[model samples]
Target: MAESDAWILTTGLNNGVSKLVGEGISQYRLLRRHPKDVVCIGLTMWGTINEKTRIDLKKASQIGASDEACKRQIRDDVQEDKETLDPHHTHCILFDSGNLNEYLSDSQRSSFVQYVCDDKNSHACKEVFFDNMNFQQRLIEL
Candidate 1:
């Protein structure tokens, strides 16, 4: 329960606050407020990703089928479910595992990759994760 330690969970993050609570920890305060006995996700802001990939390869009459349509249908279903459940959680969305690559340009991506690479063995990723907190604290300086 060190101030710098957290119990992290790996989920799609699309499930939103309910899933966060259902999995354990009633709130996102684990990221702060009450840092002890925290519950956190390694990848956040992934609601869009969860909506994009799913598999429901079952034919109308057949039990098993391998078709693009089936996969798309399943993906859509997953998206619907995730969309319905997302929201209600207020927390900084920590990006990891190339999740934010789409928003970054090639140069920015390279810079971030290098930054993270510099801390590959340490928990330096958390600094970026909580960068907003730093920004907020500096609002007066602006």
Candidate 2:
């Protein structure tokens, strides 16, 4: 996608498969600059992020808060299933469902992705589905 300047979107979370995707994109950027810069975007539920990140984000969202006031830590929360944003990702979109433990369901994520893909201003020309892949499977695909 970098070669064509396409958008590389993933379920936004600095965990598991998504983490690997972020790392791969980071390495790709470091290795070459000829084709174009890759726009790797992550979209995930706000409640899924670590407690610290969530608190910071909420504070920054206050009416009078400055954008500069927010700073995300790149560490996982102590709580299981909580995650932080990947440092390597170019952008992140966090959807808030108002509950701390609630996250976007697979159906919701799919609908959101489809909505973006159908938009005229979408970054990628096509939708790329990603699944959890073992180390060997991912390496072989490359």
The candidate maximizing TM-score is 2
Q: Write the per-residue lDDT of candidate 1 for residues 29-101, one digit (tens) a residue.
A: 4456644544443333332343343232135335555565345534233425332223332332433344422
- Model 2: per-residue Cα lDDT over 1-142, one tens digit each: 6545455667767788788888998887778855367777787787788777776766857965455445543445443557888888888888787766676676765676567656765444543444332221111110
When superposed on Cα atoms, how far off is each prediction in RMSD?
Answer: 13.7, 7.2
The 10-residue segment with the lowest total lDDT in model 1:
133-142
Estimate TM-scores for all models.
Answer: 0.26, 0.68
Top-scoring candidate (lDDT)? 2
TM-score of 2: 0.68
Q: Give me the overall lDDT of model 1.
A: 0.36
Candidate 2 regions off by >4 Å? 59-81, 120-124, 131-142
What ranges in model 1 sit over 4 Å off?
1-4, 12-23, 27-39, 42-81, 84-117, 120-142
TM value for model 1? 0.26
